[model samples]
Target: MTKTSAVFPQPAPGSKPTPRVYTDEQKSMIEELRQYALSLLLPETDSYHPNERRWIEEPECPARYMRAAKWKLDDGKRRIKGTIEWRREYKPDLISAEHVKIENDSGKILLNGFDYDGRPIITMRVGRQNTQPSERQILHLIFCLERAIDYMPEGQDSMLILVDYKSATLKSNPSISTALKVLHILQDHYVERLGRAIVTNLPMLLNFFFKGIGPFLDPVTREKMKFNPNLHELIPDEHLEVDFGGKFDYEFDPDSYWEQICRHAGVNADGSRFEPEWKRTQMPQQEQEESPKPVDSETSSTAPDLVADDDDVESSRAPSVQLPRASKPVSVKGGSSGKEGVEVIGEEEPNVLVASA
Candidate 1:
């Protein structure tokens, strides 16, 4: 199979870059929907919701909510409301950039380049992530997800999570209960924001872990989960890091991003309020657009040939914040942490994995 490049336009040497231009009609539609969503999120007559209050009011924020709703007025309004409610319950703002000290956890989480669809690619090395406290890690993950909101390309409301299972041992795999909880928060609270996922370097033992949770997922969400050793199946070479056979190497200094957050919020390490940098000029919401490279296409190449069968294990899914559903049950055994690295589900162990009641 051949590869197709993304449509991100490149600037030729000595040529000035082209500025992105939105038509007047396009701008009006975006602004109008954003304002409508705001009405639902924050009404004049009612007291303020915490989520509404804590939310960064960047202009693009509304555009993202609208895109998540596919631009349907009613649906968009409902989506925004749900997110606000979820934020209040989850209290993501409290996690802030400082709480997640990432000096040792870089292997656990990272935001990489964009995929073919222009969605930011976030890779999770599960083996690497398992070292941290589950709840802390989950909180940081949510915080990063929110942080990505500021950097997403236009028209993309979601991003991709690449769960890299390389070097995964029984001790390093995330506990079933903990993994389920993380998934629930993402699906139930975040909702409709996940674009897709690539579960790379899967070991056979954990196949049962994925299989056990498969029953809860709808076919559409499940279908989005692609199991492949090769990253090229979902993204182009230029967008990938050398670890996955791409041009660039994945290098993220967690503190650098955290400091960015600190600067944006205008707070010191102690978390007291101070004047922010962008505040001197325009608030972040009205500032210049992000300068991420475009996702160009290589249409002439053949499609990538996947080594693994898509049906062998359960697939990944996108965000779907807190939708109502009846209880569904399923079970699969996990590897033990002992010498053999196999975990047998004992009587004391959990037998059912049901995300919703």
Candidate 2:
């Protein structure tokens, strides 16, 4: 038997086996499962119409399915296996979930909380639930006015509409003052644009300027005046009969309306009386002498007497001290004449030693 090289061809070293391809039926099943998982995560909104439903529902369907479905192939085998391990690892952090829950709760509480005085903190509540505006709301309005005035079109006047249905309800609220201050600031800051305008339906404006008599029929005067109603009742076709187009509506007098408002409100139009200028009164000669004189530059230049008086007071207040005199040296009897010579004296008797020159 001729020993022909009967060598079985060894598989190529380090070569990866071909991956197994999923059958169409298996692939379809896996896709359906993935879609089911996605549906569980995101619920469909009921806002869509029948025709629009398909587009809205399937908008993120592909991405959702792709994220949800995960599979792995066994080493060089065509068998496809679904992974539940990844799903177990995909749990959302408990802390994150808790944080979201807490945030939502706190937001709800803040929106609905009341002060010690039983007043709502936030002003922008639905409907007439909270008619009175809070300090925050007033501040918000001020900021809005500033932005509006900055960007308003030229010649087209800007108007701020403050709609308050319940004037009587907010009568006792302290926030009313804050609201008024905001209005005053807006009016004063935009004085150049004063004619530009502020259109408000709040009965408080009429109450404030018209002496609180126009909105309701005056029981004492028996005068009936129209007032603001609900928004739904306001007809778009309706127009205010007053000729607001006129430059001066009442009597063609400049500042007529403002003057009238001030009059009705019992306020001085000139504001001089409200903030009067202080006047100086002439003092008696004796009183003037008694009062301390202010040291001006003229008085300071000729105050030599004052300077001499200060110097005398300083010298008198100083402690007394005796300084050694440098005028003369004491002469010692029979003292040494040479510079290097030394002399000794007894304690009891005066004795002197002299060096020969």
Candidate 3:
């Protein structure tokens, strides 16, 4: 198997690098688990996602599963078996771009850039979440995960997560059940796939949301989470966005980004799925309107309770993390380029999702 540069956060200058070493017994366990995985007769399906198949057969996969299962042979086998079953039932590979355009267009989650370690980065703008929590929302996240894996360089089995809480209010957070489902998918199905997680600009009240999901977080995954990390240390300045204190100047262009991601996923801007020779078509349009006025980040205060009980939903609806809107107007790049150009409003700005869901 191919190998990348020394594991990231390269050893401190003048310090000895402690490369990972597996004991002979651990190696044997991994070998046994690998054989067990290969011995399974998977149910015949129309097709499998390349990554899913890769996760089963790759040389590094067994070790990853064993690591996730804490080097227990039987537990590793069970984890692998469970993930295979989940993938078969979920068919995450079949999720179409048109089906998730609303969530994608919201720019709530994006797969972009790479960390210093070459792991693809997934940036989740919690503040931009506009839809109610639902299965589709989970699918959008899974879709992004599949795409992030696609971007992973060979020999690299993990990806980085950046949760941007800028302008996230208690109302913007997903329901607890939805968050738990997301955690279940990530921890149980996507074993050993998180390199690190950096949650930035989180508001004080959002702490409630984190606390709700805390118990369910895998120990390894929880340890990977870093609150308010210095972005420059993990991501190169060129790839890091200005919003996150890097030299890279990026404004989220919803239409262009959506179409680009759709095409990459073998689908058109419309709901049509196509193969190699598919032609690009014009995206549909609807009435467009400006979003609500921006809230001043420095002055706006966080809400009281982020994870309110169902009966206290009204109080939980208050906004939390507020970010100052961009001062200058930026041009919209895709279908609605005809507009005089909307001011870069708050996270609530509507860059319309044109596909019929």
Work out candidate 1's RMSD over C-alphas. Answer: 17.0
Please give, for residues 1-357, the per-residue lDDT of candidate 1 as tens digits: 223222122111121212334567656766776666556564543333433544626545555555445556566566667766665444554343444444224446665456555566767776664333434455556656765554455455566677777876666665566556656666555554566656766788777887677666644345456665346544555556667776544354555444444444343442233444434444444443222111111221221211111010113211111211212211111111000111121122212222110
Model 1 gets an lDDT of: 0.47
Q: Across residues 119-182, which tens digit of lDDT does each residue of candidate 2 receive? A: 1112121112222332223322332233233222222222212222333233322233343343
TM-score-wise, the better of 1 and 3 is: 3
Pick by lDDT: 2 or 3, better one: 3
**Candidate-wise lDDT, in order:** 0.47, 0.22, 0.56
Q: Poorest 10 consecutive residues of model 2 by lDDT?
A: 334-343
Candidate 1 has its poorest 10 consecutive residues by lDDT at 332-341
RMSD of 3: 16.7
Which regions of candidate 3 fall more than 4 Å away from where they truly are? 1-25, 43-54, 262-357
